[model samples]
Target: MTEALRLPAEKIHAAELEALKADDKERRPPGWALSPRAAVTYLMGGKAANGMPISAKYVGDKRLIETAVATLATDRALLLLGVPGTAKSWVSEHLAAAVSGDSTMVIQCTAGTDENQVRYGWNYAQLLAHGPSRQALVPTPLFRAMEAGKLCRLEELTRMGSDVQDTLITVLSEKMMPIPELNESVYAVRGFNVIATANNRDKGVNELSSALKRRFNVVVLPLPDDMEQEIAIVTKRVGEMAQSLDLPAPKNVSEEVARVVAIFRELRGGATMDGKITLKTPSGTLSTAEAIAVMIGGLSQAAFFNGGKLSAEGLAPNMIGAIVKDPVQDKVVLEEYLETVLKKRPDYADYYHMLSDLT
Candidate 1:
């Protein structure tokens, strides 16, 4: 198969989705691609009865995925909230794909997002010629979702302006969007719902109003709680991304992956793995996503420039970039970590030397 620069979850796992649909015998809600049970299986991963391979997308708690799937199966909308790198948007996309069979119906909420983008806009040329007809009315993702009875995604929901964010309140509560120009409203069909994601870091930017909050069944997607789980997540994602980009695999990536996860976990927790030495946390969040990015970038460099052998030398630059958000404060944090934790670990002598050289 020809590789796409990026593939939607539905497209990437088309066979799995098809297998789930065929294997599903349970009652499904209207317009659903698979039954709720089958949707959860698609998210959490399992072998279909026909022995088709289903790749697991989200790696955390199965119950959490179940709750997310259940939320969408009902009239209430779903809001995935967490800190960065928790895979909120990932789960949102997969859920939309599994339930609606189309993950492209997404409305990315941003600081500058406006009502017209959320609702519907008019084609001015057609509007002038046709005079307020349906043909002149351009439908947004929300409008299309309402019309076709499918799941829609709103990413970074809290990033949108408060006034613009409230536009969803009516749609969630009443299941309809009003077009004053057309003097009519588009009511949602039975399977129509929304899945939105917001992070705690942006809580104050465009805080969800209490009225708006009540409309969604909120699910908090927490960071991976276990060390091994986080390592596995980073390792698999990095490998998959590398393969998709056709980058050669690094000779020592697994070792690097484990070390990277440990460093991030220790730094972010402000303590060593043994919990003996207390360290100062950096200004940056040092999220798992950033760790994955650093590893992927380092792997790319190693593959193309360093003859496919990843070393501490290759990883140092990206590590510094990921940790040192506020150079003045975060640099001190990294320095202290190096002196206290990394320098003491005999096995990490090369890492210590490389980081020291960079600093």
Candidate 2:
């Protein structure tokens, strides 16, 4: 059977969601698929009351997940604020899936995004024929979400123009979207709420106005707290991605994964793990998400080119590519790190040489 290249969070976790629903005994907000507590359990990973195993989606703070889930249960919209690769979009997708049983109601906000995409547009063909009737109205994702009382996701909310971003003010604050052309409005149903994601570190972002900011309950998803946590996250995500891509698991990848995570942590922190050697940080985020991508890329290289064996050679180029986002300054930062940090560590000799040669 053919499969989707990517599945939305709801379809991917359908069984676990069903399991949660079966075992959930707590109060459920209207239009929610699972209770808030059960939804948190789904995200944080725990066995259901029926003993069905539920996988952990987000591997960070349980309280943060709880706060995000709780925000959706109320009238206030949720804004997941974080640096890039901090899993803002990841959490948003899963939260929408867990609460609404449908994570596809999404508006991917971009610089070119306009009011029509956020609100409603006219079906021109129908409009010309029917002349401003409801049949001529083209409902956007946000419109559909309001009509259905499900969560609508706005990704990279800050990337849109300020005027386009302001269009959400009414939909969020009043839970109503007006249609001046039709002389009618779309009043949101009980569970209708918005979940927006924005990266604080991104450039050219249209900062949220104070009025728009007040409509959302901001929950910041932070980076992994430590090396072990970051490593665990990367390992888990890489394993899952490999399975999805039909790639054979590279044997003894834990060590390589650890090394990659360590390098990212050091450069990201601008210091060595032990804090003995100060280093210049790179331009890239070196985020856990990027680490997962590097691991998966390395595994693919091993699977296709190196007789199903992972090595420093396979991981080096991708690791360097991830680190050296800005060719000049980032390369300098990485070279200093390799010379000062990895060169001295005995276990990292292979990585040091491989990365040095590539750089």
Q: What pairs collide in candidate 2?
A: none
Tens digits of lDDT, candidate 1, 1-359: 98567889899889899998987999999989899999999998888879987888889899999999999988789999998888998899999999999999999888778998999988999999989989999999989999999998999999889899989889999999888888988989878999999999744577889999988999999888889999989988898889988888766788999998899999999999889999999877788888999998898888888888898888989999999888799989999999988998998998899998888
Task: At residue 80, give the lDDT of candidate 2.
Answer: 96
Top-TM-score structure, candidate number: 2
Pairs that collide, model 1: none
Q: Which runs in model 2 stand beyond 4 Å of their true positions? A: none
* Shift of residue 48 alpha carbon in model 1, Å: 0.8
Which window of 10 residues has the lowest lDDT sum in candidate 1?
Answer: 199-208
Model 2 CA lDDT for position 340: 89
